[model samples]
Target: MRPNVRLELIRKLMQQHNNPSFMKKIIVAILFVLLIVGGGVAYYLYNKGPLDVISSHAVEISAVNLYNSFLSDSAAAGKKYAGKVLEVSGLTEDVSVNQNQETIILLRTSVEGAHINCTLEDKTKVNANKGLIHIKGICSGIGDGDPDLGLPADVYLTRCFVINK
Candidate 1:
């Protein structure tokens, strides 16, 4: 009876080792677990909220200085300021609503035709008559200009809000 039991166990082990269905089952189980984990991550990211720039800490800088940094060395300035929230102070050159109905503020720079373009998060009216207004936004880096058209490089910021300081 002991010999028969040992033979039966060895036969079962060999069948399991040679069975393609056993390997297929294991592969299917692993794939199922991976799919579940992937779906969970996708769900979490899909429900995530947008960044709250109003409460976030920002780097304080002047519009001219920020523009000059990018003009002097774009790679260095981009590493320092791009995708970062900045509190920029400058004189208002123009304020208007774009086709998307978002408020766009242009801050004057030292160079001609060059401005710090800020796209506000909301449709808030800003009085350009006020001098040296401070704006907080995510710096989007500089936009190259057309020298033939007499346009200078412009700095861009998005999701901006007026900081009353």
Candidate 2:
């Protein structure tokens, strides 16, 4: 009620906060709560299964057209295609397994060295020798190639699966 009483109360509170043991307890409690929350989140994410691309709706486009769109205006194309599902049809340039053992398919474009790089979900499903194919996957956007090195820009797709017509 009185000024002296209030001042004494504030001083006591500040002294308690300044105490090393009191501060340590507060820090430990905060950290413990944060650790529990982090662990729960990690567990939830770990138990979650991968996306089912087979049944999902996708945007259909030819590999050459997709590459041309990115080449014309990458910013606009990225906004339209990135993070979305795409069913790309084109002639197979190459198919091989990466270091991670994931099947990587390159869909050919008219431009030399440029292709739609699709990472397949099921390695055993698609054959490398297949002339033409339609693959469905999520667009991961374009990889900028080096002009001096003569590398062509590529559009990347992940979690891809062969679309059976």
Candidate 2 local lDDT, 45-100, one digit each (tens): 99988777888889999999999999899999999999999999999999888998
Winner by TM-score:
1
lDDT of 2 at 31: 100
Per-model TM values vs. the true structure: 0.73, 0.69
Instruction: Give per-candidate clash totals.
Output: 0, 0
User: What local distance difference test score does each model get?
Assistant: 0.92, 0.92
Q: Which consecutive 10 residues in model 1 have the weakest lDDT in total?
A: 122-131
> Please, what are the lDDT tens digits per residue for candidate 1 over residues 1-165?
699999999999888978999978989999999999999999999998977899999999999999999989999999999999999999998999999999999999889889999999988777867488999999999999999988898999999999997
Q: Which residue runs does candidate 1 get wrong by more than 4 Å?
A: 1-42
TM-score of 2: 0.69
What value of lDDT does candidate 1 attain over all alpha carbons? 0.92
